[model samples]
Target: MSAHSWDVRRLPSAEGRSFLVTGGNAGIGYFVAEQLAGTGATVILGSRAPAKASAAARSIGGRVPGARVRHVPLDLADPASIVAGVAALRLESLDAVVCNAGVLLDHPPRRETDNGHELMFATNHLGHFALVSWLAPLLAAAPAARVVTVGSLTAKSVTLDLEDLQSLRDYRPKRAYARSKLAQMLFGFELDRRLRAAGASTSSVVTHPGGALDSLTPSRPVRSRTAGELLRGLPAGLLVQGKEAAAWPAVRAVLDPSVRGGQLWGPRVLGLRGRPVPEPVRGDLADTALAAALWAASADLTGLAPAAAGPAGA
Candidate 1:
């Protein structure tokens, strides 16, 4: 939690491990994949956008010499593609997986994925649910494993309605995203419990970016497309932290020795437009019943329940 220990050099090199990250083509996810690759980890960048995924890998490969980076086509909304992604990965052993893929409040009307789940839920929650579940075998094959699921401060604003988990009933864009994020948090907490119950031996943690002004935010419905003009008068640091700043919570959650299962980490100042800090999140994220319900619903939606049933099996 030291404000001073935030540099990437302090992190342990992934000399003997392999990593996989979702939505890693840009923004915060970009830093996650890049930093890991810089540390000698065999990094895989998973994205629904295939061409962009390749470009991202090439970019990182250029920055970090001999950086082993792989790109996989993944679509959180399409079950077939989710299946295809896992099949394509072909990992014999995986050291860690970061579920960093997510979508924020962008469009006005609610959208559903190919599976008929709400777009937010499918992309942000269930898609990750299936990926981790499908890869559970490879995770167990490793000497040890970790899965970091990215949550958000916006989860604090959510009021979950199980009946409307898909947003079909009542559609407000931001809240829909909030509910999906809340589901992601609940999934992390519940995942730790279930992974343990299954004896998977994988450490699962939840982290948030707080509020890094990465391109991911601008992609949202910008209140003003020319909002960058406002930054002209602001202090340099306040204007926006680069993509790297947003990677703090993910990196900390992934590598920090003291990080406890189900714990949350993010920036300290005003929800992390500043230095990194492990902060408290809503107590409801730790709710067991809700997490279990979410896991069941997610498995049902993504066709991953069978993989998760009865815990990690031999």
Candidate 2:
């Protein structure tokens, strides 16, 4: 609302708080973790690669002196990885978990994860679903713990198809990715509702970074990068904020005390790219039918229960 209010400096000291974030080694996830680390939070940076995850913590520590950053190996594609990551959470109590890792379907040739789930669904949605399920207990144990999951503006572009969740019957990269993201939104909404109904203090909040694309960034949609230059170039128009800016919404979603449970926040402009603004997302993410279906499917995939949420759904 104000020019200087959203600055990271305003974030309270998270000295006693403990947090976990997947994909915190790079991209928008990194920035959110960095912000928390700056506030003295003991942050666990979950990565698919152990070595890379450690390197990211070192990198963050370099930028922010005395930053408490730890690395934990987590690959969303594998349900076992989530199990392992959860077991490795050394903290006696976890204050919050930020599910920041996500993928865009720019490459083709259709892929699938180890669990026989479509690659996009496995990594983007199922992986997160599995992770949250594992970490449910830690969240519930804390009176005001929270989980912040990242969704895409593209979530509105697709609808859930419970019959073909894994895309086993039909597969399209973009559609599958969109479908997974929608699942994330739905999971967050329904998770919040369930937490409340069960009388748990843990809350679920979701947000999107709009579209952050730049010619300088090697990793992004070609259409987006090309369009970035052809349209209006970086940060001006026709493009979303860079990952640095995108990280703001994510950081706020996790650390801001005023943020309410079940609310989705993002940029205020068209396509949600500008400054981080609090707003609910578009679509039926709160749909009970699809949420229940997703919950069951996730349990089946992970062999975990809705009641047995783990430490970190790596």
Candidate 3:
């Protein structure tokens, strides 16, 4: 909770805690798992590819001897994959679930998920929405559980369509990405409200790794070598922050007991990147009506009603 120092080494010990991180094979997600596992927390990394997830688990183990790390194959692009992934997770009590799996494909043809929803929307928002709903019971069983949704800075600039949650009319990649992130933000806040209404102890918090540079990020099996070449070509100062630094907010959101439900954390700078801090949620992102509508729409699309379920398995 010290504002002066919020780096990974400053994190508290997590001896008995457990965490699940989606897209944990690379980028911010990978580092989040690393940081958590380094502090003695048991971590399950959910990823689309088996080999990559295994590699990440190995990397964590290599970096921190005796680090408890495992991998659960999870593909956010497909609903069946998500269900199977959750079922495969046999943890007794999950302290936190980090919804970090996402896609940032640009200018590609408009695509749809196996369920016929917009690709980005389904992967970035709907999948996590369903995952959290199914795992609510496990979370509630913990003394203090958290559902951390990864949002993006682009959400601040976009306008969402309540009626057209899917990009049926217009399908530009940038717009779709922005709107999808906005949906995620809304879902996280709305989930907090619902959990509170149900008298559940689990908290729903949202966080964003502001302007993180993939160029400086530790390359993983999933990240393409050419992906950050362009950014590396530019002056290093143009980079807002490295992926490790970017991951601090998310790590804090999961491990910091002081982080409350409906609260958001981001970079200390203009969301570009520095140490983790409490970043104000913009008016649009804080709209109650929008959050409610997004929640309903997500439920409808995923066929999973948001509900507080039974206590964790123990």
Candidate 4:
């Protein structure tokens, strides 16, 4: 189908394919998983909470009959947990992985992971960096596998300080969150560059949800928003969108054949609310030098060398 003709409600079929979506237990992640399940593909929900993941899986099954869905424990903040999660998947190949899990701290003193990285940066960027590095082999095994990184509009306003990625010098909650997302976006672009350089079949793609509000989301078995809540959210809905709509860009990135690596997918209207489309890569996200620096820093911090795509089954 043409890019202009792409339809969110009627997605292309992906039968026999398999995908993994991190943070698939709630919010926009849940909707991404649900939509993918509707496409007749096996969907694995990667999350820190087993019960929540299982519940999300059940919810998908309930909504889409014969949906192939399951859960794997994955805590992005913990490298060991990521290692365990990939092992638990036990897959010879994977078609795509949506790096959708992230933390946005609204308030408080700054927090750090067990490895001493800032909480937002650790979970939002570094954890996925490490996870993708480990999954390189599995991704290589598939035909044209994709790593879809879900970024945020917040990154457009913030800047990254390579010297202090963890914000050890000055920690403000929103700035830290935005910077972490910026790093994630940069990582996506850099990963595509490296993949192309290595002649790897696996491609990296980046996308942003635009403005997403839970209050505007459709009711689901897992979490239902009251009518009153939706009514109150109507005003914001004009500027923003529900979590279901927010999942569109990432979902399109995963399934759209026309989408290419190094492209940025986002909302079409004012970049805030509308159907997903390819958007211009601007600002820091377009800075290759900055991305290269972030990639190097990520490798050093995560203690993971970039994984080259080896021969299938190698």
Task: Supply candidate 4's per-residue lDDT for 55.
Answer: 86
Q: After superposition, how far is residue 182 of candidate 3 from its true place, in Å?
A: 0.7
**Which residue runs of candidate 4 sit more than 4 Å off their true CA positions?**
309-314
lDDT of 4 by residue, 247-287 (tens): 99999999999899999999988899989999999889999
How many steric clashes does model 4 contain? 0
User: Regarding lDDT, does 1 or 3 come out ahead?
Assistant: 3
lDDT by residue (tens digit), candidate 2, 69-157: 99888998888888899889876678888888876777677887765778888888778887888787777777699888888877887
lDDT of each: 0.76, 0.77, 0.84, 0.92
Among these predictions, the greatest lDDT belongs to 4
CA deviation > 4 Å runs, candidate 1: 1-6, 215-233, 306-314
Where is the poorest 10-residue window by lDDT in model 3?
Answer: 305-314
Candidates arranged by lDDT, highest first: 4, 3, 2, 1
TM-score of every prediction relative to native:
0.87, 0.87, 0.92, 0.97
Off by over 4 Å in 2: 1-5, 214-232, 235-239, 310-314
- lDDT accuracy of residue 259 in candidate 4: 91
Question: Candidate 1 — which pairs collide?
Answer: 198-311, 198-312
Q: Which one wins on TM-score?
A: 4
Is candidate 3 or 4 superior in lDDT? 4
Candidate 1 vs candidate 2, lDDT winner: 2
Error of 2 at 206 (Å): 0.8
